[model samples]
Structures are given as structure tokens and as C-alpha cells.
Target: MGALHLMPGTTFSNAEELGDYDPKRHASLTLRELERYIALEVVGSCHQSIHSGLGRPPIAVWREDEGEIPLRLPQDRMRFWLTFLPEEERTLRPDGIHLFGLRYWSPALSADVGRSKRRLLVKYDPRDMSRVFVRRPSGNFVEARYADVTLPSVTLREAQTARRTLLEKGRREVDMRSIIRTAMAQRELVEVAAKKTAAARHAKARGSKSKVDDGGWGSLRGVDSSKPVPFVEDAN
Candidate 1:
């Protein structure tokens, strides 16, 4: 990522520019920023670069090849998209399918539990690990969600991060439940901390709230301004 490259107008650029090292910067960049950076490379600078062997820009070559290439589209778009998703071969047990320390279950998968001996092809979306698509022997995909329906959806990165954090905290084995619990706890703590920070900032901005002067003698209390009568010294 630290590799140096020449830009269209700039003298040079470091790929590591995408990495934020400033302490003031957030822990992670937003997905939109990441996607934009990827798009910039995939369809912008990289495609515009001239290919040495082809004697033309990659984008020009792609445009020329587009007309000659046959576009074969699948009848089922869902399956087509599923084919591109990350896949893993998992055994479907009577209880359900276990993946990434999470359990997934679908009523359709129950009947095939004892009947099939082959491992089923499972595909999941990294954006939402709450559900997965399992390919059946009949060539149809069965959808399954979390075994614990109450569990909130989590991203693959979040799940991995939680696992690592738990490990660092001396957890022997981290599971999906523990990951969810940690996420929930972190969210609550963040909310509380944010409120406290905001309140403190507000108070600081307004300065001390303790009242000092009563704004001239017009606002002074009667008792506070009252003078004591002169003491009489008549032998007593």
C-alpha cells in the first residue's frame, strides 16, 4: 500500500495516503469513503493508465473487448449474485448450520439434515452476517437467518474485531453471542460518554454557573443591607 505511483497531474502519490494516521481522525473510514477510493482506482486512474503490452489504455481495451464478448446472463438473478458471494462448505446438522461461530437455521434445511451426507455450499454477505444462502442438492438456494432470532445483525469486520478484542481481554473462545454482547455494551458506553462529553463542553463554554455579585445595590436584600441599632451603654 505504501507503493509510490505517478498520478495524472501530480508528481507522485503514495497508495498509503488512504491510511489515516492522525489521532484526530476516526478509528475507521466510512464505507462510502472506501468504496470511492476503490472506484477511483478501478475505474479512474488505473483504467486510464496506458498498458505497455497492449499499446493502449486499459479502458480503451475494455471498451473494444466489450463488443466481442458474449454476455450470458443467468435466468435467476438471485442465484447469479449468490455465485459471486463468498462461499464455504459447511455440514448441515440436525440443529442447524454453524459458521463463523454463529448458528443459522431454516425450516427447509431440517428435512435434508439426515438425508444428505455431502457438505452444503454456503454463501454469506459480509455486510450482514445475520443471514446466509445455502445451496441444496436440488440446485436451489435456501435462505437462513440466525438461530437466535433476537441477535442483532452484524458485519463480518465487526464480528472479527469483536473476536480479536475478546481474545485480547483473555477470553479462551469467543462466540457470536459474546460478539453481539460486546457490541451492544460498546454502543451503550459510547452513548453515555458522548452525552457526558457534550454536557461538559457546554458547561465549560458557559463558564462557572456560581452566582457572585447581585448586580448593583438595587438587587441587594433588605436584611443584608439593614444596619444594627447603636448599642446603648447604660451600665448594663
Candidate 2:
């Protein structure tokens, strides 16, 4: 299949520019094949650019201003939209593509879990089919919306191997809840400290103003005392 290279904000004027393009050739792809193609094209772009440092510019398949990429497919087949990040942004971490994430939208919810927010959804773990509809908040996995997949059967040894791979890939050791809680606590502390500093500044200003007013009153008292003795004798 010919590669489709889409640039952001540019109109794809040349359907002919898709050199040796043959839609009929891939027309026989099954639903699974199409899904796999979508996944591979999107994730492969990200992985190659980010991890490999292969000096390729990221292609923006979906126009950002368009809100979402609209895909029209046969009613019987599942359809999805794929978007990828730029090469430079993708390589900050080992699992940067996974951490960065992608959105998957389906017109009909899959049979696994029947919660119907079939509009737009994000997935972090592309390899793990079980993590199909889970959402991430700020580079951390927060919650799963319609998680109803059975765990893949694997031997204990295989599970251990997978765990080791995760650790090596910088994907493991994330205590998301603890990290969020600590961040919140730190933010609250900063806010409280700011309020206290402001209050102290106001108090200092008031104290300085009070001292100036007291000095003015003292001067007035001295002048009154100097003039009071003569008025008091005349009244007597």
C-alpha cells in the first residue's frame, strides 16, 4: 500500500499525488485488518519518530480546528480515526507514545461493555486489549469507562517476563493516585502560603498607618494643652 502523508492545515489536493495509490487493492481487508492498519499506521509513526529518532516530521492526519476526524465506513464495519504527535514531542520518555495516548471513536459501542459514549474516547495501552476504553488524565491512567475484557491467559513465568519488560520500558512504577494526591497537597500549601503573605503585608501597612495617626494626635494634644490654661482661668 502507498503511504499517505498528510500535513497540518494543508489541503490534500492531489489524490493523484498518492503515487501508485490503489484503494481497490486494500478493499478486501477485513474489519480486524483495517483496525490493525489504523493502529499500526498511527502508533508506528509515533514509535519510529520518537523512539528511533529517525528524523521524520510528524504528519497531522486530522485537522486540529475540525474538532474530530470524520470517518465514513460501511454500516456493518467498525470505523475509527487516527492522529499522531510530532517526532520531537514523542521522544521525551520511553513509552512516550503510550503515555501521550490516542483517541478511538466508534459509532456503536463494542459488545464487551455497553456504555454508550460512542463519540470520542482515548486509549493509553495499545498492546493490552483489556485496556480498550480506559482514560488517562495528565499522562497518568486515571479510570476505565467500560472495562469488561477478560485478562489474557498467561503463565506465571510469562507474566513475570511482561512485568520486567514494563519496568525496562519505563512504564512501570507509576502510583498515579499518590502522585495526584501529592500534587494537590502541594498546590494547597502554596495557595495557603500566598494568602498568609498577603495578610501579613496588609497588617504591616495598617500598623504603619496607625503609628502615623497617633503621632498626629500627640501633636494636637500638645497644642491644646498649651492654649487651655488661659481659657480655664477666665471661666472661673
Best by TM-score: 1
User: Which pairs in model 1 have colliding backbones?
Assistant: none
Count of backbone collisions within predicted model 2: 0
* Regions of model 2 farther than 4 Å from truth: 1-172, 209-236
Best by lDDT: 1
Alpha-carbon RMSD, candidate 2: 29.1
**TM-score against truth, every candidate:** 0.53, 0.22
Q: After superposing candidate 1, which stretches have Cα over 4 Å from the reference? A: 1-29, 32-73, 173-175, 186-236
lDDT of each: 0.71, 0.35
Worst lDDT run of 10 residues, candidate 1, spans 2-11
RMSD of each: 22.7, 29.1
Clashes of each: 0, 0
Clash pairs, model 2 backbone: none
Tens digit per residue, CA lDDT, model 1, 1-236: 21112211122244374333232221222455656756666666556768788888887897899889988878889988887899999999898998877889999987888888999999999988899999887878999999998999877777777777898999988877998777667757766876776677456646957332223111223333367534232242
